[model samples]
Target chain A: MTYCVAMNLAEGLVFVSDSRTNAGVDNIATFRKLHIFGTPGERLVVLQTAGNLATSQSVISLLRQRLDGEEANLHNVDSLFEAARLVGSTLQEVVEHDCGNVQRQGVDLGCSVLLGGQIGEEQPRLFNIYPQGNFIEATRDTPYFQIGESKYGKPILDRALNHATPLEQALRCALISFDSTIRSNLSVGMPLDLLVYHAGSLEVPQGFRVKEGDAYFEGIRAQWCSGLRQLLGELPAPPGDYWS
Target chain B: MTYCVAMNLAEGLVFVSDSRTNAGVDNIATFRKLHIFGTPGERLVVLQTAGNLATSQSVISLLRQRLDGEEANLHNVDSLFEAARLVGSTLQEVVEHDCGNVQRQGVDLGCSVLLGGQIGEEQPRLFNIYPQGNFIEATRDTPYFQIGESKYGKPILDRALNHATPLEQALRCALISFDSTIRSNLSVGMPLDLLVYHAGSLEVPQGFRVKEGDAYFEGIRAQWCSGLRQLLGELPAPPGDYWS
Candidate 1:
């Protein structure tokens, strides 16, 4: 199980992902799910992946392998949309090559990714690419996409985020979503990778590789827990009829 | 599809369930999933059903049928444990009687239940009964159980609930869980059945069948949404490194 979320906000793009991967309870390991590909002022491409570890890593390797060729790399793509297509086709190629054998052993070949970043002066964009090699781009109306262990964290995003949210607030929203997910689910553990890209400033975007005991993440978790308890305590109990 | 949650708390027990049923999105309809079966003073048994509507209805019918005969029924079960076992076996009987026929038409025979309440002098109890007829009681460490479309709502319960939570707080927590679920999942909807049983009382429990326009539920939903948004606003953004 894994969790990766990316938001295409009005100001920029925010990407957050957990680093835990497991074949089974006893086979747990940490593997970074967020991959960054960039060429400074020309383009910034980020991939946050979830589902089968092997399939995603294979897809990433193919994407990286293509970087050496002049025709097909993030550095040379005309737009984020084309970059998304390249990533999707690469994923499809990898799955087609490995799925048959993997499925024979009863392991699902599932993998999906949230691909987002800026290309020159164009607005930052995000896309969710499915394992089948098809994809959906986030629209202003629905400015974020999540992959894996999504439901437990979705409600917070449904309430707190919008296309017009400030970049800082969007980061807060994504971490709150992550906090909720990690608290409820054991499979998604700490050491989070986060990237905040300012719309046009394509330089290595400001971000953090947050770990357990990190002051900022720890503060947010503690405050959110007690804050929620306090908020619920403040609400009026259901009316008399609701109880009796 | 349905969403049902039941909690065993120190003050008593709480059960809440949505009333949606669908063969497909276009074939959706409403059906109450909460059922009550017991003699008021001697016992107070509540059953919340989920999964295949037909299988659950059949299981419910068998339980009701036993009430008119000489064999043991909810009214005669020695403890809530006995009541859960009875419910489980009756469910198994219903599945055995109908599964093969149902599966021939390409429908799953799935059905599960949350069984909770008190019997005679026994303490309040809750059990999650599986389709296979095996059931497990909620322990102090994990005092609640949810069935059907459970993931979206699970985080709230995981964060806010405990075995010793007061009855009123438990109701609030369950409602919050339901609100999150209903917002994220279309299959779980309004017109909910809620029952709160005070431990050791064994009398008629207090509860309501809440509908879409119910004032108390509306208030809880409104307060929670804004409360969450406000809470996120107050939390410090990830350190300067996170946003730069």
Candidate 2:
């Protein structure tokens, strides 16, 4: 289980991913789901993965192995769309290779990927790559993509996010969304990987790792909890007419 | 699809169910999922259903049919636990009767039920009856149960609800949870049915129907959204050190 979200806003893009993977309740491990690729001053691509650990790791490993090769890879892709296609195809390849044996044992080998980045003069773009090698790009009306354990955290994004939102504000919403998910689900745990990119900036964005006890994260969690309680208290109860 | 939730708290029980029922996106209708049973002043039982509309309706119809018969029924049940067992077994019977034909057409015949109320001298109790004809009672540690499209509304309840939560506060939380679910899911919608039971009050509890233009509902929706935005802005964003 995993929870990864990325937002494409007017100013830039923001990405957040949890680091927990579990075979079951008893067998759990932490793995970085966010991977950074592309040249420092040319193309910057970020990939966040969820689903079968083996399939995602294989897809990432294949992408990395091909980065220095002559093949069309994240580094050499002409645009964000092409990078998304490359990632989707890699995901499909890994799933196809392992699904037969895995499914025989009643295990799922499917993986979902989020590919977001900027290329040269193009604006930052975000794509949700399905397990079947197909993808959809984020647009002005729908500015965010979430995969894996998405519903628990989706109401906030649906209510607050839009293309006009500032990059910093979008980042805050992403963290709050993650907070809701982590509190409701045990499978999605910390530390978290966060990345923010300025639109049209062709530099590899700096990625931040937020671990347990991070002051900002803890503060947001506590404040949000108390704020919600207070807000609920302030809301008027049902009218007395309804209490008959 | 449907969304129904019930909470067992110290003050009493709270049940909230959305009225939307859909066979597909284009085939949607409004049908009450919350049902009240029991003899007034003796026992008060509320049943909330989710899943295949045909199956849930059949279960309810069967229970109603047997109310005046020699067979054990909700009105005749000695305890809330017995009422839950009756609901669970009725659900299983309906599914078993229809599953073969339904599955042949690739349709589901399963339904999940939430049974909560007071009977005789027992305290208010809540039960989540699965499609398999088995049920689990809510305890002090876990005081709520949600069925169908539940995840979108679950984070708030997970954070704010406990056995000791005041009945009015619990009712507020339940409404907010439904609001979140309705915003994020098209399958769950307006005209919610809300019922609150006070412990030791054997009389039938009044049920509130909250429609689209209800003033209090609209106010809560507006206030919760803006309050969340204000809280997000007040929380300090990630430290400058992480933004490199």
Candidate 3:
């Protein structure tokens, strides 16, 4: 399992993803799920994936392999929408290639992807690409997309994030969301990959890789936990009459 | 879908459940999921259910119907453990009776139950009964059980709840959990049914049914939302160096 969240905010785009994947409890391993594509200062496209590891890896390899070919790829795509379509189609191609043999063994070959970044002069956009070669772009009303192990971390995003949120604040909220998910679910673990893309930069910014005991991540976790407990304690308890 | 949570805390037991049930988005309706049983001053038991509404309703109806029969019933159970077994078996019976026909149409007939209360001189106990007629009791290390639409509301409970948490605080936490679920999931909604039992009382206490305009519940919602926003703001944002 994986948890990847990306937000297309007013100031920029924020992406956070956990690095753990497991075939089973005993077969746990770390796999990087965040992939950066496109040419620096020309087009910046980020892809975060979840679901079947084999399918995602294959899709990523195919996307990278096609970059030097004549066919459209993440690098040469005219817009984020076209880039999303290419990713979606590549995912579909990979699944279809392995799905027949995989389905006979009752294994799922589906994968979900979050594609977000700037392409040339267009504004930053985010898209959630499903396994069936289809996608939906994020809009102002719903400016974020999350894939895999999403529910445990969704409440904070629902409560705190919006299109107009500053890039830094959105990054913080995304980290807290990951913290909540990692606490409740063992399938999702650190080290985490975080990227904050300033709109129109068309260049990947300096991303942070939060490993175990990383001071900033640790501080945020401690502060968030203690702060939540404090907030709950301060909230008025139900009236005595309501109990009786 | 439904959201019901029960906690066995030091002070006593707390149960909170949403009332909405839906066959589909267009078929939404209200049905109480909380049921009170056992004789006052002798034994007190409460059941909160989620899953197929028909199956839960049938299980509840059968439990009530058997109360007057010679067979053992909730009112006649020797202990809360016995009561949990009885509920579990009754649920299994209901599901088995309808499963063959219902499953032929590809509909699910499973339901989950949370049973908690006291009997005679024994301490209060909580049980999470599965559809297979098996159950697990809550322990000091894990004193709560949530059924249906649980993930969206789980982080706060994981952060703030413990066996040592006071009954009032546990109740408050349960309500907030329900609020989070309702906000994120369309399947779970109000009005909510809440019951708080004081340990050793051995009698059913007055339970609160919170409706849409209920002032206390509205206050909690307002306070929790604003308080969470304030808390997020006060927490330091990730350092600028992380983003570059």
Candidate 4:
């Protein structure tokens, strides 16, 4: 299980991904799901994946292999959409190669990716690529995309995010969303990879590896919990009418 | 799609369910999902259903018909476990009768029930009954059960609920959970039915119908959105050491 989220906001983009992967409860392992591709001051593309770790890793390696070729890469993609297209095409190639054989063994070839970043002069953008290689771009009304264990973290995003949200605030909300998920699900754990891009910057944006006990994340988690309890205590309750 | 949650807390039991049912987004209707069976001073049993509306309705009707008969109804069951068995048996009966036929047409015979209440001298209890007729009782560690579209509403409960939680506060948490679901998914919606039971009080537990515009609900919803925004503003920014 994994929980990865990426948001496209007015100030820029925010991406967060959990690191825990498991075949079952007893076989958990850490696998960083965020992959960064770019040249400083040129272009930055962040890919966050969730689902089968093997499939996601393969997609990443394939993309890197493509980068090593004498052709288009994250550094040279003509547009953000084309970068997303390259991702979709790579995912499709992997699926076609393994899905049928995996299914015969009762295994699923499942993986989804969140591709978000800036390319040259294009605005920062985000796309959620499905297992089938189909994808959807984020729009102003829905400025974020999430994959894997998404629901637990979704309410906060639904209520707090918008196209006009500042990049810093979006990063805060994204972290909070991940905090909510890790607390509620044992399968999703620490050592988060987060990236924030400044729109049109075309460079490696500020990023972090949020491990457990990281002071800032710990503070946000504690404050968010306390704030929720305080909010709950302060909400007006149904009159004694309902309980009497 | 539906959202029904029931919790067994120190003060008593709390059950809340949304009323929306739809064949598709274009065709939606309201139907109560909370069913109560009791003899005013002797017992109070609340059943909340989610999943296939037809299956749930059939199970409810079967239970009602059993009550109409003089011997095997919930009213005659000596223990809460027995009552749960009765509900599970009814669910099994419905599944056996229609599940195969339904599957032939591409639909599943999906349904789940959250059964909670007191019977005779037994204390209040809650059980989550699956479609296959198996059930699991809520424990101190797992003090609540939610059925159907549960994810969106889960974070609040995972954070705030515990066995020691008071009935009123637990009920508030449950409502906020439902509010999150309703805001995120059209399949889950309004006119929620809520039942809160006091420990050792077998008959006629406190209850209410929380509809759109219901004063207290409206207040809480308004306050939650406001509180979330305020919290977002209050959270500290990314540390300057890492964020530019």
lDDT, residue B92, model 3: 85
Residue B112 CA displacement from its true place in model 1, Å: 1.0
lDDT string, candidate 4, A1-244, tens digits? 9999998888888888889999989999999998999887667889999888778899999898878677766667888899988898888889888876786887878899999887776777899999988899999988999999988889899998899988888888999898888887899999998887778777685578888899999998999998998898788767976675
**By TM-score, how accurate is candidate 4?**
0.96
Superposition error at A175 for model 1 (Å): 0.7
Model 1 per-residue lDDT tens digits across residues A1-244: 8999999988889999999998778788899999999988888899999998889999898888879897777778889999989988888888889877778898888799999998888888899999888899999999999999999899999988999999898888888899999988889988999998888888766457998889988898899999999888887887777666
TM-score of chain B of 1: 0.96
**Candidate 3: what's its TM-score on chain B?**
0.97
Where's the lowest-lDDT run of ten residues in candidate 3 chain B? B235-244
Candidate 1 chain A: 10-residue stretch with minimal lDDT: A199-208
lDDT, candidate 2, B7-48, per-residue tens: 998888889999999988999999999999877889999999
Q: Pick the candidate with the highest TM-score.
A: 3
The estimated TM-scores of all candidates read 0.97, 0.98, 0.98, 0.96
* Chain B TM-score of candidate number 2: 0.97
Number of colliding residue pairs in each model: 0, 0, 0, 0
- Give me the candidate number with maximum DockQ: 2
Candidate 1 retains true contacts at a fraction of 0.74
Candidate 2: residue pairs that collide? none
lDDT by residue (tens digit), candidate 2, A1-244: 9999999999988999999999889889999999999787798899999998998999999999998999898888889998888888888788888877778898888899999999988888999999888999999999999999999999999988899988888888899999999999999999999989888777786699999999988988999899888888888887875565
* DockQ of every predicted complex: 0.71, 0.72, 0.71, 0.63
Where does candidate 3 stray beyond 4 Å? Answer: none
